[model samples]
Every structure is written in C-alpha cells, then in structure tokens.
Target: MVTRREVRLSPSNLNYEDRRCDRCFAEAANGESWPQGPFPGIFAKLDSQQRRYFTDRSTSDIDPTLPPGTLHNGGRVQSAPHAIGGVDFTIRGSMDALLRFDDGSVGVVDFKSSTASPQLGDAYRPQLAAYQWALSRPASDDPEEVSVAGLLVFAPESMVDTEQGRAYLVSTTWIP
Candidate 1:
C-alpha cells in the first residue's frame, strides 16, 4: 500500500527547522500541526496602519521614506501542489504589500515593526525570496514579468511620551 500526504509550506517556516519538521511529519502521518503564539497588540495595530498607508498614498500620514511606486495589498500567492523528493507540498504566502515601479516592474515590500532597529538577517531572506518567486510567476507560469526578486523592509522609529502615549518618531529605515 502507498500512503500519500499533503503538506502546506509558508514563508515563515523557511528558517524554523523544528517547526517545519514537525509540520511535515504530522502531515505525513495524517495529522496536522500549526504554529502557536500570542499575537502582540502593538504589532497588530502597526500592521493595520501599514496596510492602510500602502493602499492610500495620497493620505497625509503616508511615510515619505517609502519608495515611490504604486502599492498593492491583501493578496496571497500560492504554488500548485507538487512533490519535493516524493513528499507532496504546497507553498503559499500572504504579501504584505506589492510595489509597481514606474519602469513597469514589481517589487515586494514587507512591513516590520520593532522597538529595536530592524535588520534583514538571514532568517528573513527565505521569506522575501519566496514572495519574490511567487509574484514572478503570478498570472501565468511565464518568467517575463518578474523583474526583481528582492524585498524592501520598512521599520519606523518610535518614542515614548507620558501624555500622548507611544509615538512613532519621524525617522524610518527601508532595508533593501
């Protein structure tokens, strides 16, 4: 008898070895495994605000530091189920934002919030690369449309104020 398993892969799991293994094995055994954690309130708020900012560049609150391009949001990219070394798997990821450049090329943008300075470490490379690959093949299996396979990360600086609450300072960085 032959046993078949369906596995789902996400960009977040690219760097997590144990979690990835658990999910893969669970699916192979006809079980399911998902990441568990407490979502932070501040992170949620920041995510919402960033989405809004990308959707409406005309708004006064738009961050001037962001690259000049038309922004897109609320879309997910998925790959057809395929076997990797005999294990069936599907890779999918939700794009935080997509930037359409003046040159008619598209780029991926992921919004990140942190009290500390943000860095594009190796841990994040796979996630961004996945997004780049997905966006490239969107609409068809052709590669002519995908121009850049890189991502820009935006992290805003914040400051604390007793009266007004935690305020995001003017300084922001776009990590390429």
Candidate 2:
C-alpha cells in the first residue's frame, strides 16, 4: 500500500542508483578532501600520444623511464554484458592499454604518470577491477572466452637534483 506521491518522491527502482558502488562513493568522498589528483594534468598531456600509440596498438619508441621490457602493443577494449542469472548486470569499462605476448594471452595495461605516490587502496581496486570484470565478460554477440589479466603502469616524473645536478627517476607496476 503506497501512495503515488511516495513512489514519485522515492524512486528506489532506478537501476543507476540501485547499482551505485559503495567503494566509489566512499572514494569520491575521500577525493573531495584531497587537494589534487594522482598526477594533475598528466592524463591530458598524454592524450594525443595515447590515442595515437596505445589506441592504435602501434609500437612506439620505448620510454627511457619505463622499465626494461619490450613494449609489444597497447590498446583499449570495451566490454558489454549479456545476462546475469536473475538480474541483468551490465558493466562498461575501458582499458588504457592491452599488451599481448608472443606465446599468447593479453595483459591489460593502464598507464599513469604521476608526481605523487600511487594509492593501491580499495578505492583504486574497484576501478581497475571493473575494467578486468568487464573485460572478462563475453562480448554481446561472441560467447567465447575473454582475458582477465592486466597491469598498471605508473611512470613517475623525472626530477633533477639541484645539489647533485643529476637526474633521478622512479616507476612502478602492479598486476592483479
């Protein structure tokens, strides 16, 4: 027994609202308190290069700052859901880069250039997990298997020591 006004005011049946990720909400809240993002304007600066090199999966000159590994290819992939038991769970996500091995299997790679230390907390976990989760889901038409392996690449900014007049660099990678 519910009134029209009550139903109108409280739209609890909305899918978007109902599927809100608690971790995202909490992280957003925490982010509000922070002064800056991981690498302010880093993504923007890399946009053109990312679109050209990564999205196209073209081999570019290896970044000297990056670790000693031959970069094969890189690109982004979007995954759509088909069905999920009683409930229909549709997830959408994009990866920065997907690297392939000479043998087989692809690895999801997300590139990031930062001035701050990487935060590998649950907040960042779900974001990356969503990408893996979506990538794991079978394509809308294709019902075959999907790759779930991936990596996060963080290339820190190069800083020159005024006292020593030498350049120093730091980089890190995470896989899950």
Candidate 3:
C-alpha cells in the first residue's frame, strides 16, 4: 500500500505546474513528482545584483509612485496548510522584494527578467496571491498586513562596455 504526503506548493509551480495541465497538478497534489529543469543562471545573477542595489533603499527608488517605503529582499514566507478549492496545501516561497510602508503595511514586489512588461495575469496572479497569503498568514512570523502587490520587470535593452566588464542596460518597468 502507498500513502500520499502533503505537497508544499510553490508560487513558481502555481504559474506552470497548475496552469499547464490539470492532471499534472492533481498528480503533484497527491505526492507524485516530476523532474524540473534547472533554473537559468542569468536570472540568478540579476536577482543577486538587484537585491544588493535595493538593499537599504526605498521603494520610491524602484517606482516614483511607490509608498517611499523601506526595501527588503530575500524574505522567505510559508503558510500553514490550508484548503483551496477543497485541496489542502501550503504556500512556501521567497519574496523577491518586500517593502514596509510608513503606515505599517507591507508591499509585495516580484521581479521578472524579461524584455517585455510581464502582466499579473492568470499565470502570475496566483503566485502573487500565494505570497500575499503566506505573508499575511505565515506559519511562524507574526502576521503582516499586505497593502500592495506588483511586479518590477527588467528588460535588457543594450550592452555597454564598462570599466569592469560588459553590463546590460536594463530598463525597469513598474506594474502596480
């Protein structure tokens, strides 16, 4: 006899594993597994560099209309197991960026390495919703009320020869 274990659903998987196929999503929910491709390293480098740039900075640096809140990175969030559409699941994901507004509410910001502005559509909103859920209802930390959620898209436009090395001119777009 076989027993199934609970699944730790990630925001990344919610974008693809759940949206691509119903059978795959159900199988995963039942503890079935599949090999996933390795994440490309370029995005990793971009994330690392941007995190450093935004560290100790303000949200207004990213977007002029933002709340001028303090910027935070590498925030890990996990939600206690709960039911969604009759299926029990837990949200576990690292926030790309979290901003603490002056009013004491938190803003959730996700970064996308892309040439076009990525919309928070069917493929992305669920992931943001998952982050919202985990931040507002974490398994360990005191609950933080989420005031806003959006994306910061980085698009590589041109390459510049710099003193250290070649750097890509990345254009950022804020989608609130």
Candidate 4:
C-alpha cells in the first residue's frame, strides 16, 4: 500500500530556491539553491549613479528638503524588504529590488555587478522581467505597473582583491 501526501502551493508562499522558469521546471523538479551573485556594493554604485541623473533631470521639481536617500514611505520598502512570487510558481529566480518613484509611479530595478560587460548574461533580463511581473500583481499593494529597469554597474577588481578598485560606468536600461 502507498500513502498519498497532500501538497499546497501559493505564489506568495513559494520558496525562492525551488522556483524556476518553464524550461527549467519542465526539465527538473524543484531544488534548493539561492540566486548567486556578488555583494550589494556593486549594485549600490549603479543606484548612486541613477539617483545622480534623477537629481539632475528633476533639479527644479525635486524637493530640496527631501531626505538623503530614497524618500518613499521613509524608505520602508527598501529598509524592511518584501518578496512576492518567484520566476516560476515555486521553483528558479527571484528579483533583487523594487523601486517606487516620488510621482506615484512604481518600477522594478535589478542591480547587477560584473567584472565583464552585463551583456554576457541572459539571466539579468528574465530576472528583471519576473520581478516586474511579481510586483505588478493586482492583489499586491504595489502600484499597477512597475516600469522594468536594469542597472549593470561594472567594477574591475584589483590584482590582489583589494578595496581600491576601478569602476566603469555603463548605460542604464529603462523599460517604459
């Protein structure tokens, strides 16, 4: 005699490790693993650059008294952190960040750090797209649409792996 086990599933409660896209999910069962990448500093550099541009373009409209960092809900979204569905129902990739602008427009921004060019990886595109989709869920308190955006900040390392490194600025991609 064989015993049957009841299984439960949900987009929100899904495990990040087991989630996967259609291709991967069809090929294999859910596995335990986290998205791999460098530290957050690389992404921070790119964000700093983007903010600089925002400041420049909206110099006149931007409130001078706004706090130093992102001011949305006192940066609660960034500070506290939140996660939605994965790339698949419960099996591959997870988005890194969800950004909301001051104009009531929500957007998805993925931070990528690479020694080489960002074009070398396809993961960045789908990963960001998945994030935008998850953030755009109707039940979610998130706004209607999160303009998909990808930022690739490349930082060349020193020969000895030291903090004194060189950073090359690349163009930021925004999907409106």
Candidate 5:
C-alpha cells in the first residue's frame, strides 16, 4: 500500500509556475528544490506599499462599484491538508488584500501592476481558488466564508515629474 505524504504549496505555484510547465509542477509537488528567477525589487516594494495603503480602507477605495466593505486580512492564510488524487496537500499564501463586507461576508483581492492590458479570469483562477480554499479550510485559524475574489489591476496612465521625483499615475480596475 502507498503511504500518502503531505505537501505544502504556495498559491503562485498554481499560477505562473504550474501553468508554465508540468515537469516543474511535478517537481514542486514532490518537494524538489528549484530556483526562481529574479524579480525586480521595485514591484515588490510597490506591492507592499499598496497593501499598506489599502489596509482598513473601504472596498470602494479599490473601485467605486464594489459594495461597502472594509479591507483586512492582509496577511498569510494556510489551510488544512486536502486530499487531491489520493495525495494530501496544504495551501499557504500571503493575501494581497482581504475585504469584509458590511454584511460580514469576506472577499479576496490580488493586486497587479501592469503596463499592458490586464488579462482577467483564466490566468489567475487557480491562484485565487487556492486562497479561497485555504481560507475556507484553515489549518489552525477559524474558516472564513469567502464570498468573492477578484483582481485589482493598476495600469499606468500618465507620468509626471515633481520636486519629490517622477511619479506615475495609475488607473485601478476591479475584475470580479
């Protein structure tokens, strides 16, 4: 009889990495070590700042059309092991933003800064689904009923130079 082992996976693995290659995904699922390509630090910094800036703010801040909700859960969420195809797997990931609607339902939002037109749905479905699964089936913390998930796309609209330095004004759109 094969004894099943537990595996821990980050949500991004389900996104770009898993979608890109099957061998890499298998290696990751089997706990093989792999090197990630260098990502520009500026994007990380901007993401961090954006997370902070939106914390405790209303969902309207992301896009006016969203319901009245407060931003929260800007941290990590890990789920209990879930059996998938006879193997146990746990999803742990840092959420970009979590929203609590006035009615108490929760939502997850991820931020993306792009120069090109953003692609919604398919590209990010697995990643967002991982978070929703993790939140609804937590390992230690109480489970959250995730009512919605979406992407907040920030695309550059204009650039200007001021005494402080150069700045780019971005446009935000919520794709649910």
Candidate 6:
C-alpha cells in the first residue's frame, strides 16, 4: 500500500518561498520539527484589543476602506489535505480577522507591528495572499468570496515624556 504523508502549511510558511523547502516539509511531515518563533506578548495584547474593539463596535476606526461588515476574530482556516509531488499537505493558518461584508463577500485583514510605517513589499505579499486564498475556499463558512485583503500596521511614530511616564505616539497604516 502507498502511504501519503501529511504536512501542515500556514500563511507564515507561505511567506517563505511558499513553504517549498523540501527538508522542512519532510521534517514537518515526520512530526519532528515545525516553525518556531519568539513569543510576541505585546503584539498579542495589542491585536486582542483591536479585535475586541472592532467586534464590539461592529466597525473599525482605523481602516475606512473596510465596508460595513461583521468582524470575525482570529480562527484557524485549513484546506483539505492534498498531495503535492506525492506528498500530502494541508494548508492552514490562524487568520487575524475575516470581515463578512453585507454583499456576501469576505475581507481578510492582518495586523502587524513595526517601529516604522509598514511597507507592502515582497516579503509580506505572500502571507496576505495566503489568507486571501484560505478565505476564498468553498469549504469556508459564509459566502467564501474574498473581495479584498489588507494589512493594518501599527508603528511607533514618536516618543514623549508625560506626567505619568514616557508615552509613544503610534500610527496606523492600511495597505491593500
């Protein structure tokens, strides 16, 4: 009997060469090693706050281009395991948010933190595209129609001393 190995793919993985590294794929398939990163507590807190704000208000003060929609918080999205080059792979990701538009379309939004204004360069495009692809899949809930995808980047613009303590001036940038 022929056996097909399973591998998991994520948006972050897609950011790196579309997760085509044979060695990494093999390791992940064997359940030996997977991607790891330093914990981002501050970013997580900020992301949670923003998500809650949008969810509570049913709107976003940051991105005006976003249509009237209901914000769905972070969740796991996955594609059925499939074979690529004889290796079975399941593309999956924890999307930051999915906006279900009134017109039966969905919008993908990713939150990013940086010291300077975020740029929509080559490094980040694949990650956003992966989210767009995941949301557009027929298996996804709702209409599964991806109308738009974007990044909501938060950056520190300045620092100032206040009566309480030092405060940083933050700026938000939306890149579609």
lDDT of 4 by residue, 1-176 (tens): 64432222222223233345654443343343445577578556666655554532331223333222232211212111233442324212333343455655554444434443445334445545544554544323543455434533434343343367744444333322
Q: lDDT of each model, Cα atoms only? A: 0.58, 0.43, 0.80, 0.39, 0.83, 0.70
The candidate maximizing TM-score is: 5
For every candidate, C-alpha RMSD to the true structure in Å: 4.9, 9.8, 3.0, 9.7, 2.0, 3.5
lDDT of 3 by residue, 123-162 (tens): 4777888899998888896999998887778888999999
What are the per-residue Cα lDDT tens digits for candidate 2 across 95-166? 566544333444455554433233533224455555555556534544323244333455655777777787
Q: Candidate order by TM-score, highest to lowest?
A: 5, 3, 6, 1, 2, 4
Q: For candidate 3, which ten residues in a row score worst on lDDT?
A: 114-123
Spell out the clash pairs found in candidate 4: 18-91, 19-90, 19-91, 19-92, 20-91, 20-92
For candidate 2, the lDDT comes to: 0.43
lDDT of 4 at 94: 36
For every model in order, what is the number of clashing pairs? 0, 1, 0, 6, 0, 0
**On residues 1-176, what C-alpha lDDT tens digit does candidate 6 reach at each position?**
98876766677666645456778755664677665687678877888877776663443565666787677785878765556887876668898877778888877778777533334445578887777666665244643778878776778889999999997788878777
Model 5: residues with Cα > 4 Å off, grouped in runs: 16-18, 115-118
Better of 2 and 6 by lDDT: 6
Per-residue accuracy of model 1 over 13-129 as CA lDDT, tens digit each: 564343457656455344455455887788778778778765744211234444455766737887666676667766677877776656667666666653223344444667777
- Candidate 1 vs 5: which has more lDDT: 5
Model 4's number of clashes is 6
On lDDT, the stronger of 4 and 5 is 5
Candidate topping lDDT = 5
Candidate 1 is scored at a TM of 0.67
| C-alpha-based local distance difference test score of model 5 | 0.83
Worst 10 residues of 5 by lDDT: 114-123
Off by over 4 Å in 4: 1-94, 116-118, 157-176
Residue 54 CA displacement from its true place in model 4, Å: 14
